[model samples]
Target: MSQYVEQGYTAFADHYGSSEIIFGQFRRSRQNTQRIVGATKWCVFRPTNPTRVVVEAAVQERLDRMQTDCIDLLQFHWQDYNDKGYLTALRHLQDLQQEGRITTLGLCNFDAIRTDEICCQLGPGSIVSNQVQFSLIDTRPLHGMADVCQRHNVRLLTYGTLCGGFLADQWLGQPEPDAYSGRLTPSQRKYLDMIVKAWGDWTLFQSLLVVLRQIGDRHGGVSIANVATRWVLDYPCVGAVIIGARLGVSEHRGDNSRVFTFQLTQEDNAAIDAVLEQSNGRHLITAIGDCGAEYR
Candidate 1:
């Protein structure tokens, strides 16, 4: 994000697990700090323990860590399926928004039904957005989340659009990854499992990659990742696609910036869809359940 901001590109940083480490990087680049949107998640406020004190402390801690007076977006995550305390947490977040501590309230990995329920409980136009795992391989949001979001005016801030880098040129013709491979990062291992579950085989995925490569060639030779990100960006209610820029380890700012330069044609959609349709005996929409189902 600091690199992107240095190049004058706007970035959003999430305070998920490593709040200090991630937000600390942004703090170092104070010159371009205003270009970044700071987001953080609340994990401990469950049905049994939700309280105003918890929300206030979490928000303050995030503000202190990010070195900001106000959070651009505060996203919440719930673990228990039967938890009803999420409603209380949202109310408190809304209060924080009114108090100028939070600019927007959003959800991470929330299913359609629960999202709708929250909207109703808080009244219309309650949620500003939702962040979820959305990609060609994980179109679960389309099953029902999109419609609910449309009704409630909640846009989807999508992640995993490239399936943890699996949907890139590097993996095009590679052999199926062994589960026990030491080379697989945790993200890669997780998404590879999703591919096997959503589609059926690695060979089929290679075929999809070939189609994406063909599409990329038609679009001035963009990478497979660009095509994948572009496809998700084009999905209904998708406000943005989150791509991981491994900071100093590697950078794709130049390639990623190209996603906005071209649009996918009808033919491009058809070619990609054809390969996906024949996978796993069903469309990704139904192959995976609604948004957040994988966690449930």
Candidate 2:
């Protein structure tokens, strides 16, 4: 945490764990010298009535867990679109925001339709961001979410930008790993399925790695992961890319920092698009449903 703060990274997102542990470590590391932006998610997967009391309690729980009077950003995640309780929850959250309990409100894994509807119902600036899966392999956001975000001024916090590390140089010329093998991490399994069944086959994915590698070489031998991240960050609607890291176990602070050193050229984009044009990138919106459809 101290190293991250030293590197000028202030934003931290937490969910489904001991937020107090993380928040306390952050505070101690920061030493109150720099502002730490803490973002957390409240996921309501099951159908339930979100009464005023229920919603307020939920917000208060997060505040208490984080040891803060107000949450920097509270992202809501709803599993079922059939239920209208999410709207009620958001309304309560908005009321809490008005009362200064939350600085900003956002959504998690919401499809473009709901995102548009919520923004319209809540009015402009009610929602500030949406977290979703977006990468060269999964370009579902481009189908509709990007347009809705642009219309409503909602930035996208993208995950899967590195395709579970498959976009790295280590996988450049490697053969596909067995899905059932115990070696693959959970994220690797999920994204590997997306690549083979939804996005493209292994051969096609190798082609993408080749293109990314070439682009990396052109940009002063940056890693393939750097090129992949740079592609997602280049999008106008993307506010940040959420790259998973194992704190103390492994870190990519130096490699990731290189993503900001250079911009992809029109030629670089063309090369990437050429490979993407042959894949099922466009059909993923329907194949996997919308941005958060997989979870639903």
Candidate 3:
């Protein structure tokens, strides 16, 4: 946490259960001199009536857990679109925000249509950002989310940008692993399904890795992961790419920092587009649905 602060990373995203640990680390880092923006999610998967009391308690719970008076950002996630309770929840969250309990409000895994609806109903600037799955493999955001976000002034905080590390050099020439192989992490299994089922076959994925490697080589031998991340960051609407880290177990800060040092040239983009044009990327919007439809 101190090292990341030193590197000018002030924003930290976490879930409710683990938010306090991150907040504690941020509080201790650099004697609290640096400004820390802690963002956490409140996932309501089940149906519920979001009364004022209900919403207040939920926000207060986060405040108590993080030991903070006000939340830097609170991102809400809803599972069932049929249920209108999410709007009620967001209204109360907005109320809390106006009361100064929340600094900013955002959404998690929301589709473009609903995001537009929320922003329109809540009035412009009510929603600041939306966290969604976006990468070279999953370009659903480009289908409509990007346009909606641009129209509403909402930034995209993207995850799955590395496809759970499948975009890295270690997997460049590796054979497809069994999903049932207990060795793979949960994220690996999830993204592996997207690759073999929704995105393309393993052979096509290897082609992508090869092109990424070639591009990285052009950029002074940066890793395939660097090129992959740079591609996502290059998008205009992308505010930040949320890369997963194992913390003390392993860190890629050095390699990740390389993404900012170089830019992809026209030839590099053309080479990558050649491989992507042959894959199922365009069809994924239909197969998997937009933005967060897979979860629904």
Clashes of 1: 0
Ten-residue region with minimum lDDT total, candidate 2: 24-33
Off by over 4 Å in 3: 28-30
Model 2 C-alpha lDDT per residue in residues 27-144, reported as the tens digit of each score: 7555466788889998998887999998999889888788788889999998989998889899999999999999999999999999999999999999999999999999999999
| Whole-model lDDT, model 2 | 0.90
Model 3 steric clash pairs:
none
Q: State the lDDT of candidate 3 residue by residue for 164-258, as single tens digits.
A: 88999999889999998896889999999999988889999999999999999988999999999999999888999998887786568788889
Q: Give the least accurate 10-residue stretch of model 1, judged by summed lDDT.
A: 24-33
Q: Give the TM-score of candidate 2.
A: 0.97
**TM-score to true structure, per model:** 0.92, 0.97, 0.96
Clashes of each: 0, 0, 0
Local error of candidate 2 at residue 237 (angstroms): 1.0
Order by lDDT, highest first: 2, 3, 1
- Per-residue lDDT tens digits of candidate 1, residues 1-296? 55677665765646656755567565655763275666677665335566899878888888777777788888888877677777887898899889998888888888898989888899877788888988888777887888998899999989888888899999988999896769888888888887886566888899999999999999999999999999989977898887876777757888888898889999999999899888763465465566777776
The better-scoring model by TM-score among 2 and 3 is: 2
Q: Which is the leading candidate under lDDT?
A: 2
Alpha carbon lDDT at 58, candidate 1: 80
lDDT of each: 0.81, 0.90, 0.89
